[model samples]
Target: MSPVRRQHVILRVVAKLLIPYILLFALYVQFHGDYGPGGGFQAGVIFGAAFVLYGLIFGLERAKAAAPPRIIEILVSLGVLLFAGVGVASMFKGGNFLDYGVLEHDPLAGQHLGILVIELGVGITVTAAMITLYFYFAGRGRA
Candidate 1:
């Protein structure tokens, strides 16, 4: 099927309207995760879903233009590095790997910061991976 044929006025309008709300919720989940059940994984999925929805309604090329492949690849790597760097930083602080207690002068603050950083890294990686997967699958049959 031609990519242009996928565009429908209603679908595009709905998607455009919903995408912001979805992203807003994703941010909420990411930030509120510390006190609730939601976290990086859920937030990432939600964020990715918005883009995937855009692709489904708009087109893969447009989606790709919105999140270029090179930028996505960098994000994937950067996320992993951020996660690992946190662990390594803890080690340097004379704490065990993944030790959040050493991240700040106050143990509680340190733990909170560590968790935030870790979750952010995870969210980034998951978001990039999901978008990458969508691109690959969507591109499969295209000429």
Candidate 2:
């Protein structure tokens, strides 16, 4: 991956500037997904992408410092848990699993929020899993 990426101070600076906002936007996308085309899954990918690029340039250790393995693993589980937990919560609130209506005082709005949160969860988990997998095998079979 590092070999594939062209290294330049400008690109690194650009990436550094963009990464935080990208992650922040991912959060916005995750939370506001009900009314938009974005969702947690997409947000996760976008979020993970920043670090992936970072790793490609600076090496895995720096990337890990940005997002530690333990934290990433937890985030991976947390996102899934959040999605599933919402589903279960909805079930108890007289709706089917993942039904958003039970999420708030207003069922319609609740649905929107619920979907956003769940999608964000999916994104986080997926992104973390992908990065983790990449790193896990990144060092293997490389000359």
Task: Say which candidate scores most in TM-score.
Answer: 1
Stretches of candidate 2 exceeding 4 Å from the true structure: 1-7, 139-143
Instruction: Report the C-alpha lDDT of model 2 over 1-143, residue by residue, as the tens digit.
Output: 35545457787788888878987887787666767777767777777777787787777778878788888889889988988998998999889988899889998889777876777678879889878876777645452
Cα error of candidate 2 at position 78, Å? 1.6
lDDT of 2 at 108: 86
* TM-score: model 1 vs. ground truth: 0.93
